[model samples]
Target: MEEKILLKYIDVPDIEKIEVYQKHDGYKGLAKALKQHKPDQIIELVKASGLRGRGGAGFPAGLKWSFVPKDSGKPVFLCCNADEGEPGTFKDRLLMEKNPHQLIEGIVITAYAVNCHQAYIYIRGEFSQAMKVLEQAIEEAYEHNCLGKNILKQGFHLELSLHSGAGSYIAGEETGLLESLEGKRAEPRLKPPFPASVGLFKGPTVINNVETLSNVPHIIMRGPEWFKGFGTEKSTGTKLFCLSGHINKPGVYELPMGVPLKELINNYGGGIIGGRKLKAVIPGGSSTPVLTAEQVEEVAMDFESLQAAGSMLGSAGVIVMDETTCMVDALANLTRFYAHESCGQCTPCREGVSWMAKIARRIEEGKGLEGDLELLLDICDNISFKTLCPMGDAAIGPVVSFITKFRSEFEDHIRQGRCPIEKDKSIKVRG
Candidate 1:
């Protein structure tokens, strides 16, 4: 069943305006936090809520915040990871476009909770409409005293700004984002002094996805117990899932965190298009490992369950593929993307991803040799966990998963000298 916690007012007309948002109790959570709870108390409440980061990595949000030292002698910063670069993921873009104020209120409350006075929303550059809407919403928040100096007259100050990226997918990584925000190359940095202790401008920083921060207001307003009532024991609260690919009704759905993959496809997504048999599902975004149809039957759409299923609930980008889809061709297309997007910071990811793409493309083009499949797997082994960041692992996931689960298809392409699946020309397979 769908639970509209973060998206409760998403479809409400004029919800983007500060006046309309306030009328619907928009900043009440900020008010409550300012009046009743101290900074640490807010963190404790969030920790109790079991809110995890929604930006791929399922780290606990409250625990992440607690890592910031109480008296660090340097200013604390909050960064909203709005770089929605994952293929088939657009939930963050939708939230920023339709209900900008909701996100703004969430950011302000988070800044207050972590003693952060300066913050940045490092958004994807192509989101022009979202940028315009957010600019206006920020001004309106300032006019209403929801941001800027002495917010809500509580003597808490914050300066929120927006920085546009050059559409680098690597910038979605926390360290990569900090480098981009600092006017440097958008490549990830080494961790040890993690962002909680040392980040932007050499200060403690808390970076969270737009959806993750957007949940703060609800948790503060409704309390942790109420928020926990929606999802499973470990994975609490509702999540915004971006359902795409071959489904009948593909869009962003707000459902309980642990909704079954079958339920989401049948109930909310209206099942597969043309009533065709399900072939495979990428359960998360394109970066997560592909799941065979059998694997998805009973899999729950949550962090633990997906990981246990040998995949991940990455960004909740549910990409569905029907039987007509060609597995060899699919793997080739995904590999090509990672090959192009690699920052080339690490030798293994740079050279190995390109090699994987070349092999997959050759396999799809019916020019594969008998040793090609083994070679592809070998490349993935070298790339996985051998880079500066997880981009290497991300690149290898689809390649390894496709070749493992659908090895026959790759073999058929090699043995028969062509793609075997007769794809439907009328139905388009979206990213």
Candidate 2:
């Protein structure tokens, strides 16, 4: 219930303006870094703050920055992964739209900390309004000499570019985003030589999520101790949770890490719609496994706790479903999303996802055979960790999780030749 620290600038009038932002202690972080701290010291502070990537992977922010070889003469690039294509997630869009300068300030501070001279904000193509805000903010920053050529009178320089992807879910993946930025098809590259070692024109690069970078300015301005004061011990800092589905109040809520699921649903999300009984919850985005109401009450919304519950704090898209929602239909809907989004680069993902979607559709439609459940499990096992990227694993999470959590619903479809939850319609379908 605390006022949002990250979204503090959201309501500031003319927040995109550099002058307006600076008036509100916006560039103070870059100024502090420029005046007092060395690159390594800034990195140390970030490490101390315990900031993890909010873009899903939950990788340590400072650790990721440290991977860039400082001695490498190659130009280091800092890319803010603003291409938020994850289903049921839209927090990044709010940050970009309401407070573009906050993201810019954070990016500048992050680039300085990582000793990078150039940075890019790779926004999704569909976010036309967000793109406009960011572009205008960039131009304002340039005019104020905050973005290019000796920022804050320090010897350090930074150039920020706004690059939009052609709207692909795969583009949200780090390697795939890199490929898209290079003016090629957005397919993920192999990861022996990770992006920190060689990336973005084969130079040492650091890619961070938009939300992760947005936290930098605050960390630098308020000090690591102040920033670490909130959230759990391991997962520090507040997270922007996009609450949706059957909730009474379906909206974005910025809460600290380790917030109880019940509190988040009841207090922030206004409880379930129409006073319907809580059934299940996708703790993270669609990629995460659904948690039954009992599991939801026990699970805390954080990286470690969610992982321990056989799911992940992926993108913080909390989709709450009531008892009226059928698990079979939900799984089918999510499977279709992944199937449509697969880039067709790898056989397992391209084929396995499509196969799963087909079978799920059949099951949802009451045409499922007896062996279809076992076959679905088989497909999930093959696709879980055998592909080029996490996409395959993500594709299989819902299927495996749904069957495990709601086996009776799946069996009912196969046995009675109709979804048990929907007697009149034979199947449950809703948008």
Candidate 3:
């Protein structure tokens, strides 16, 4: 209900300008952090604030910062995962486009806190305008001596670079982003030798989501208690929720973590478009399972609650579907995306996702056999855990959930030789 912290400067004209951003108390966080707080003290404050990663994984920010080997003696690298490639998610783009300096300031403060000498902002290749805005803002920060060596006369030095990804969803994955940054193919590396211990050229590094790092300025400026006052106990601070599809006011809404899904849809989203009845909602991004309208009432728009409801708060991409939307067709759409996006490094993900997509297409086209549902489930089950990355499991979530929650709709397609909802229409065949 309170005014948003992340979205506070969103509506300000010329928010990219250092002057405008300074007018809104932008670099105050960095100044406070450099002049007063020790890097460890800042990390301690962030830990006390209870800020979790907004980058879909829901990892604690302070815990992640602590993962950086404090005495590695190597130049620590801080990378902001700004590849906003998740389907039904556009909040990061807005943040970058509107308040570029906020993100940069956050990155600087975070780099200082983590003892990183260099940082990179990995922007999505498709986001040319966002890149331009960020570049201009970075130049201004350097001009003000807020970025380069001896920032605020505190003797801390940091170099920042803006690298554009070659357009892949998997690149949003932390390890994959690192590979892409290294000018290699974007493929996820194994964890444990996780990014903290060995990342970005086998040095100690910290990779954070765009929105997660963007909150650092606020956390430093207002103090940990001020930020902790916003969201729930565990999920502290505000988040940008990207609401889309069938919603009257479909756009990004910055709200607290524990806000109810119903309130987000009805109040902030202005309910369903055309006043249609809400059938289902994907609380997170495309990777998460759909929540029926009834289920949305009880779920809070946070990480733990959504996970408890058999879904995740993935990037906070809330895609609302109306009654007229067909579950089978929707799942087919999402599965096809994953199938096309799969890196093909692992057999289960590469082969299984493509197979599932083909079967889902056939089922949607009404040519599916009686045993096809079981086959689809089998393929999804096979691919869920037998892959190198979460992509395989994420790709299978909607397929398995669709068949489980709306089995009758899939069955109707097989029995009736066309989608039951669109019975009069011809089924489009696809391989």
Q: What is the lDDT of residue 415 in candidate 3?
A: 89
For residue 266, give model 3's deviation from the true position in Å. 0.8
Backbone N/Cα/C clashes per model: 0, 0, 0
TM-scores for every candidate against the unseen true structure: 0.98, 0.97, 0.97
lDDT of 2 by residue, 1-431 (tens): 48567887777888777788888888888888889999998899999999999999999999999998978889999999999988879999999998888899889888988888999999999999999989999999989878999887898899999998887999999999999999998899988799998999999899999899999988988889988888999999999999988877787889999898889999989888778799899988999988999998888998999999999999999998887888888899999999999989999999999999999989989999999989999999888778888999999889999999999999989999988784222333333
lDDT, each prediction: 0.92, 0.90, 0.89
Instruction: In model 1, state the lDDT of residue 138.
Output: 95
Candidate 3's C-alpha runs over 4 A off are: 423-431
Off by over 4 Å in 2: 1-3, 423-431
Clashing residue pairs in candidate 1, if any? Answer: none
Top of the candidates by lDDT: 1
* Residue 265 displacement in candidate 3 (angstroms): 0.7
The digit string of per-residue lDDT tens for model 3 on 89-110 reads: 9988998999999999999999
lDDT of 1: 0.92
